[model samples]
Target: MALLVAGAFFMEILDATIITPAIPLIATSLGVEPVDVNVAITAYLVTVAVLIPATGWMTDRFGIRPVFIAAIAVFTLASLGCAFSVSLPMLVAMRILQGIGGAMMVPVGRLAVLRYSDKADRVRAIALLTWPALAAPVIAPALGGAIATVGSWRWIFLVNIPIGVVGFLLALKLIRGGPASAARPLDWRGMLALGGGIAAALIALESVRVTGTNWWQVATGTAVAVVLLVLAVVHLLRTPHPLITLSVLRFRSLRITVTAGSLYRMVITAVPFLLPLQFQLVFGWTPLRAGLMVAALFVGNLTIKPATTPLMRRFGIKRVLLVNGVLSVLWFALLAVLHPGLPIWLIAVILYVSGALRSIGFTAYNTLAFADVVGDDLTHGNTLNASVQELASGVGIAVAALLISQLTPLVGGGPGAAYSATFLVLAALLAVTLIETLRLPRNAGAEVSGTRIRRRDR
Candidate 1:
């Protein structure tokens, strides 16, 4: 179950990351500006963010087997659509379809692993489940770059067809879970509020990043999103059978990890989005060269995984998070100072360390998220965590786009300075999460980490 789900999960993430290095190529092919191609990235993620709230309910209502099968089919077909798209809008439309499939596929797939594994094996189960997250980014840049340079960029999307087919066949043969649990009444009000709020806010952020969007439109979108989100919070709190159980936030471990992890994700997620663009646009590197360079980040990600479990066992979650968070922030800050002429080895080393820190930090966050969650509430906890991850990643891209666009005009610097300013902004955002890490109790998540920490007064 873990292997099957992880394979499907890798397809989703690989689809997401592989497109990063190809964004510039696609923009030129589609006759759009480089900045405008970012919409393709944001569109898919925003669709996922908006619809992810409904995943738990959908899986419950539809049964996991059929739903998972359908998600794979949709994602596979949509990949074809993306490959054949001749225009930006067509590509964006295909991406939205792809997002809907991903929104259903990822959380439901994880839920299967959670249901199958024992608590004693959960750390290992989640590690196996999440390995794709590490592996996909590793392969995406080099593969995507190679395809874009040697052939048409369309092959990037087309490559998913075989993987999706294999996943579907294996799922049918090996996945033999029971019927879905009794269905919960759909939370229509919460769904509308949260979905609309998130969509509007993301669109507003994207609009601000564009060159000629009206200021009033941005203000109105922002205001509407804020109001709708506040109302969504109120409605969820008061209603029975809320779409997502925010009440789970009462768990200190879950709350801190979600709150802090969302910030960390928002900042770190921007790197993949911005890093490729900077390499191609600012450094004047070819897509293949840029991707090979970015592979250093991938190398770092892969190298750190085997060490994660032992590190948590030795240092405890709180200490590991603090140290990793600090190093991650420092490396991100380092990006702001890099120039086109830097030696390749130094750049590779920087990217490698940054990726290692990211891998450690994310592993710690994913493990600790479930530390305090118990039976029956496990579904809700998984749903909430998945939604936050998607939403934060979407906003991260939007935030990077907006920062670059706005700072470009204000700083009176070229594209390099614009990218550097954006990196600093993301670094500052990530640094804020360090404060949250500091506030954690010494023994936080000790139950899961298997490390003992003596209590100390804060």
Candidate 2:
């Protein structure tokens, strides 16, 4: 079941960025500027993020099995739509449909895993789920570059067809979820406000990142987003049945991941986004070459999987996060010093370590998040975590893009200088998470991790 969910997770995440390398080809084929086609990607991410708050409701109201299978079918059909798109509008529409499917698919699947799994086994279950996040982004660039180089960019979407079909069949055979007997009514006001706020904020951030978007529009969007988000929070706190139960956030273990852990996710996600562009624009490398270099991160993420659980169980979540956080900050700083003249092998080594650290850090937070969130709290906790992670994925790229744009001129140099500055700034921001980690109890998350015994024996 976990494998089935992970496969779905991989396909969903893979489709998100596979078109990245094909952006130029897609632009040429559709008769638009490359920058304009970026909407297709943003549309998918924003739609997914905005709708994720409703995952728990969907699963509860519709029953998880029917909803999950429908999501697969929708995603499969949407992939076909994306492949056949004739223009930018068509592609963006298709991407939005894909988002609708994904908004239901992965998180629902994860909810099933979390809901059914034994507490003692959550570490393994979450670790299984974490790999898609680790492997998909790295693979997408390299795979997309190869496909776009050899064939039509449409193949990127076409590739999802078979994967989705297989996943659909597996889901039918394996997934078992029934609707809650006493599901609460949806909080329409909270739903509208939260989803609207997320959409507005993402648009504002993306617009700010773009070179020529009007400041008045950006300001208005940001203001509206702030208003809606504030309203959403208030409604969630006071409403009979919020889309997501805000009370679930009172769990410190989960709250830490939602706040500091999310920041770390956003910051780390930017590395992949920035590295590919930096490689092409600065090092004058081919897309394929740059992508291949980034694969070193994948290698590291894969190789380090075995040790993550053991390390956390041995040293506990607080120490693991603290060490990983400190190292990740230094890793970003190391990336800040990268230059075209640096050896390729050295760069690969650096990225490899970065990926290793990334895997460990993410797996730690994900596992610990639900350690203390048992029973009914698991539903809202899972939904909230999934939503934040989705939002972080989109915002990370936007934030990276915005930072580069603002820093490029300030550096008074070139793309390389701007990139260096961006990495340093991100490192400084990442350092902030460590402060939060420092305040956590030494034995935090020890129960699910089995570190309590280790600490006692020592």
Candidate 3:
């Protein structure tokens, strides 16, 4: 069950990251500017963000097995459409459809694993599910670059078809159950407000990042997004059986996980977004070589997974997080000083350690988030977590882009200086996350992590 869920999660994440390296190639093939093709990426993230809130309801109203299978099928067919697209509009539309499928696939699949697994096994289950987050982003750039170098960019989307097909078949045969209990009514009004609000906010963020966008356009987007989001908050708070139960956030574990964990995630998420651009633009490395260099992070990520659970058990979640978070910030500080004159091996080593810290930090955050959540609330917590994660993925890219756009002129209009400035800013912001971790009770998450921290008062 963990493997199946993990595989589906990997497919969704891989699709999202694989396009970064191919964006320019894709734009050229479609007779558009590289910057314009960013719409394809933004469209997918926005779609997923908008649709994620309703995933729990959909799984319950429909059945988990059927919903899971259908999502995979939709994603696979959309991949075909994306591959055949000859124009920018066609590609963006197809990506939106793919996003819809992904929005359902990931949360529902995760819910299934969480519902069936015992608490004692949660660390292992979450570790399995979390691997895709680390593996996909690190591997995608190198794989996408190689594909672009040797063949057409269309292969990037086409590659998902086989993985999706296998996932769909396995899900159909292995998954159990028919329609789930729909005791609670669907919150249609809440869904509309939340989806529209999130979509608007993402669009506004993307608009702010674009250098060519007019000031008026960014202002309008920002205004509309804020109004809709405020309205959504009101609706969710007042509605009976809200689309998602906000009350779960009252728990300290979940509150910190979603809020501060998201801040940390943005920095980690920015790596794939920034590393490729920095290497290719600043160091004058080819896309393929830059991608291969990025793979060191992925190797480091995978190498550290088996140790994560044991480390948490021995050290406790809070201490582990604090140590890893500080290490991650320090690593980013090192990356801020990277130069073309630096040896490739040295750069690779830094990335390797960075990857290890990223994997450990995120795994700790994700596992601890659900430490206090149980039974019926698992669906709500998982849904909300998934939504925040999607939002972070989009916002992370937007933040990175906005920083570079703002810093480029200040740094004398060079790509290398702009990227260096962005890393430094990110490293500084990431320090705030460590402060947030400090707020965790000294013995926080000890129950779920299977470790005890000795307290001074005791």
Best by TM-score: 1
lDDT of 1: 0.85
Q: Which tens-of-lDDT digit does each residue in 1-458 have in candidate 3?
A: 88998999888988888887766678779997554565677678767876887776788888778888888999999999999998998998999999999988887888788877899998899999988876787678789889877888899988898898888889977776466755457888887877777767666666654356667877887788788879888888888788777888977899999998999987787777688777766787766887788888878887998899999989888889999988888888898998999988999999998888988988899888989898888878887887786777677776777777778878875778888889989999889898889888767788888786577612
lDDT string, candidate 1, 1-458, tens digits: 78889999999988888898888999999997777677788878878876787877787788777788888999999999999999998999999999989988887888788877899988998988877877788888988888998998999999899999999898898665555668878899998999888878876777774367878978988999999999999999999999888998888778877899998988888888888899999898888888888988979988988899899988888889999987887887899888889998999999998888888988999888988889877767877887888778878887887888888887666888988888888888888988888888777787888876655622
Clashing pairs in 3: none
lDDT of each: 0.85, 0.85, 0.82
Return the clash pairs for model 2, or none.
none
Q: Which stretches of candidate 3 lie over 4 Å from their true place?
A: 1-7, 30-39, 87-89, 110-138, 165-176, 181-183, 209-212, 455-458
Off by over 4 Å in 1: 1-4, 112-130, 169-181, 455-458
Model 3 clash tally?
0
Error of 2 at 296 (Å): 1.3
Q: Comparing candidate 1 with candidate 2, which one achieves the higher TM-score?
A: 1
* lDDT of predicted model 2: 0.85
The full ranking of all candidates by TM-score, starting with the best, is: 1, 3, 2
Better-scoring candidate (lDDT), 1 or 3 = 1
